[model samples]
Target: MSLIDLSKHVALGIDIGGTNTKFGVVNHRGEVLEKGNLRTDEYEKVEDFIDALYEKVHPLIEKFGKEKNFDGIGVGAPNGNYYKGTIEQAPNLPWKGVVPFGEMMTAKFGMPCTVTNDANAAAFGEMLFGAARGMKDFIMITLGTGVGSGIVASGKLIYGHDGFAGELGHTIVKPGGRKHWSTGSEGSLEAYASATGIAITAKKMRAEFAESMLNQYPEEEINSKTVHECALKGDPIAIEVFRYTGQKLGEALANFVMFSSPEAILLFGGVIKAGDFILKPAKLHMERNLLPIFRNKVKLVFSELDEADAAILGASALVWEK
Candidate 1:
């Protein structure tokens, strides 16, 4: 066995998505020095995926490896646990059962490893290198395919007893509304405030209002990005779509603020790129729903993270934490 250096200032970050696995080597300054990706769906077994990952990532690890200067690896995945370093029965992943993910990566790479839910990793990235820098108490909300959250209190990310805490996305926002396809849960925030939720709403709006500019696009084409583009073009129906989405998101956030009393709620992900078209209504609704004490206190802001680097940076940030 060859000796390894454990004192490097740079860390390896890996963000495992359902479709792709993004990996990178990053320094403490939040800069990614080397990066690459692989199609996750290509590997049927988790072990195969890990082997492919190790094969692909090892060259960078060796090239960037400096004597006693390289930090360990960090990973972010759906339903990942920091304590166990395992990926639980994630609905989106190819694996069917709990996989000892972090341990596998550590052994393959020969270094320390930490794993956490992607949302939690995003919060870490925000705290270490993005908007939440220097702040202790805040919540990072990811409004993507599904709503995801990471709560920070007293400057620490809350992991709860089972390491599955901070699932604000599944909280009931509408008591009897749409059913979540995966969990069979009705009216959850994830069903109302996510990009999928927006697409669903767009369909309903298209049906009710014939004048919708969305009518020009096919059903499959009516996604969040299209809606945002139409809204920017002064399309009334598209504008209303964002309005409704923002209202629900805002109300849910208002409740979140009352419970956690966070200083700010940082919004991340592609949907927020709609900018004030979504944020204005969200901010208005959030403040309106907030109690007297919390009304004017919590700040609603977009993330400062670079879309390209955020995932890797967030995952890498965990190495520093560990």
Candidate 2:
């Protein structure tokens, strides 16, 4: 074991995703000095997961501490609650319910630890160092398997009454329409706006257009990326799907803007890579739906932060701020 120094100002950032858990050492300037990832499926139990995390991260901390001063640790995960310092009912992880994640990490590393929902963390990362930097009020939306959001109003992350306030994806956009049997819901924003949701919508549209180029891909293997590629190649069906998804998102965003009156709306995640296919239509719809006071007032933008680094930065910002 190497002798560790305590004078360094680096903080550890950890982002736990459905497929992977990423960790990094970052400075106050948001420069990531070291980073790594672990497969989330490798562990069967939460304890096993934590043990593996410690095994991988402890060495980095020791190494960095030997060469520079280091601070604490910050974490971001699905269903994470900052107030409880726990992750409750995360859809991706195998853990059954709430786990004292922050306390467990602190106990293992002997450092201060904090945690927040992945979306909230990303929002904070964006506000502190990414696209939303310098903006006081904004909404950050992550459009992945599901639509996740972080609401910042008056320069603060709104945790609501129970730390579950920013579930923009679950908001109902269409009542008594497009029912999802899994959750017993009808026409949720996520059902149409997320990557999986868009893929489902694209598949349905593909059935109506027998001449669509998307037929090149098997029906069982269609994905958002495939649809985007086809749309970029001028496939009408693919284009329509993008337009529809964006329209739904835009309408939902218009409602959010009315309530929050945010300065900007920042979009992140893989699905947004469709670029103009999604953004242009979303902007048009949002503008069309907005009230006279909000029309043309709020700016819609993309995340400037590196996609791979966002979660880590967000997680690390929690402890770094301390």
- Give one digit per residue, the lDDT tens place, for model 1 in 1-322: 9754433478888888888888888987887888899998899998899899988988887788644367788898889998999999988899978999999888878899999998888888888888999889999999988888889999988999989988998999889988998899999988877899899999899889898889999999988999998998999999999999898899899899988899999998889989898899999999999888887888888889854367689889888877
The lDDT values for all models are: 0.87, 0.87
Each prediction's TM-score versus the true structure? 0.94, 0.95
TM-score for candidate 2: 0.95
Q: How far is candidate 1 from the true structure (C-alpha RMSD, Å)?
A: 3.1
The list of candidate 2 runs beyond 4 A from truth reads: 1-7
Clashing residue pairs in candidate 2 (N, C-alpha, C atoms within 3 angstroms):
7-69, 8-68, 8-69, 8-70, 9-69
lDDT for model 1: 0.87
